[model samples]
Target: MTMVSNEYGKIITIEQAVEMIDDGCSLMVGGFGGIGSPPSLLQAIIDKGVQQITLICNDTAFPHIGVGPLVAQGRIKKAVVSHIGSNPIAGQLLHEGKMEVEFSPQGILIERIRAGGAGLGGILVDIGVGHEWLAKGKPTVDIDGNRYLLERPLTADISLVYAKKADPFGNLIYDKSARNTNPLVAMAGRITIAEVEEIVPLGELDPEEIVTPGIFVTYIVQSNGVDWKWIWE
Candidate 1:
């Protein structure tokens, strides 16, 4: 593959991008199941044998989809996710005491990530007030005669994201529902790597269509496309 570069010099190969992620690092992945996930990047990580990862994402996806293969292969030490029902391996690992799982409400999970990107300490919400599982060990705040749980902001050492199109500068556009959590996750990482199906020249993308600005992306890798057959099986 020819090296794509711009004045910002953010474009890089998948191997070079994955090298930035060390063992035991916190990783925030953007996707709703397999839709928006960066398959080539995730597969590269698996091949690199990076271990003890703390994965933060919306769901575990299916065993052969998205981040689920990482979870199934025991690559993750802990997972902070909204749901793991789609991937039985995650449940099995949790039950077998091989992995740690933190459950977060879908809305709150993205909000917490948003807060991290915005550089806020945390956010207060009442969604899990009376639920023991959600409220356990959490600090409560009282205001206007009501109590709310203080959900701490979440940030990651590295974030992996998939985009439908991106410029060399990393301005990104997602395909429909695949955009879920990617914009938020893009901002919350110290180093954000975006795998894109197409990399257009700078200024070719309309400003209004770019969901994630180039400033939030540290690197951009060309994608090798995902095989959707995994989903049907």
Candidate 2:
């Protein structure tokens, strides 16, 4: 389907955005730790009380921040992520066998998202080949007499992304450091829902700055403050 620019950019509250996601969905959340998190949206989702989510992200943050509330509420069933060191709740859940965790290297995670966005089956990376994780009994296959590990595609039913600015065309631009995982996550979903701090007219955004194109985006919502646990604030 072709994504067209709308004259009137539909602006909805954070509550409206969270209601669109249902239970038992594969969700790709854009952020690293708590940096690029869509806090208000996360809170709304926690309020909605949806369960059995398969969350895909770079890292899982702490109990009170980022995806923490969902984990604290026992909403997430599984998570495929790169890092989990910061979130002790996640660790406790993993130990208790309450939540399933699939760990991936950071680079491979990005490649998996890219593959999904491009409609590819999977990605083959040497990073996992002969690694302790794979050697310890994970599946491996030989391709053309070369041993390679398969990193499955990370397609999501819904993608929750935070951006600095979004044009009515659905094109997105994210600020520095905040852009982590956002662009890739946006493409890897069937329905890409973006939360932007600012919404601008179509063509207002520079072509060079457009990280996510309009075709991949399905919805746009405006957001207020982000949720970050400071070590700073």
Candidate 3:
């Protein structure tokens, strides 16, 4: 069994943060690909060798980017994602029957995650009503003669996020495009950990600039910044 620190403060080491994730746990990762992904945290989890992760993310990214290494190493047992086109490994795993992938329309996927965080049972959408795969196994209802599929909420056992800056209390502000899906992902996890490039003192961050309030963050880890070369290759 892994020994996790019992310290009460939200600031923790990357190693300590990854310990909270066990094998077979559901993980929500915030990123469009490699851009906003928490690289150091993800690498730490890979080093720990926790397997059978259920990953929820926007995409699988490239083989060397974002959550791609996890998929390449067969760490992921299932994925709930918008697409896997960017990551050939993920597509291969799906085609070879080694992994299960649940495809959701991009907009609806994020909405489901938001609904999860907001404590809603689910949201109704008409986007996939006639589609064979998207409509499968989902219940539907008609309101005012318009039919909609019930897209259930999505929540994870743990969530990993990246931020541009963070305070001791865990208030976060993200970099431009890197902010994608992170705010919503932060709210939907039972335990949300943020990997930040810089940690500032409390009140140093302008309130107007804070995108994710400290209330949603459970832990903060200092980032060992990503290698852009690997992501660009």
RMSD of each: 1.6, 3.9, 4.2
The TM-scores of all predictions, comma-separated, are 0.96, 0.89, 0.95
Name the regions of candidate 1 deviating beyond 4 angstroms: 1-4
1 or 2, greater by TM-score: 1
Comparing 2 with 3 on lDDT, the higher-scoring candidate is 3
Error of 1 at 49 (Å): 0.6
- How displaced is residue 75 in candidate 1, in Å? 0.7
lDDT of 2: 0.83
Task: Give the clashing residue pairs of candidate 3, or none.
Answer: none
Q: Per-residue lDDT tens digits of candidate 3, residues 47-158? A: 9999999999999988887899999999999999999999998999999999999999899899999999899999999988988887999999999999999999999999
Candidate 3 structure, TM-score to reference: 0.95
lDDT of 3 at 54: 98
Index of the highest-lDDT prediction: 1
**Candidates ranked, most accurate by lDDT first:** 1, 3, 2
Q: Residue 39 error for model 3, in Å?
A: 0.4
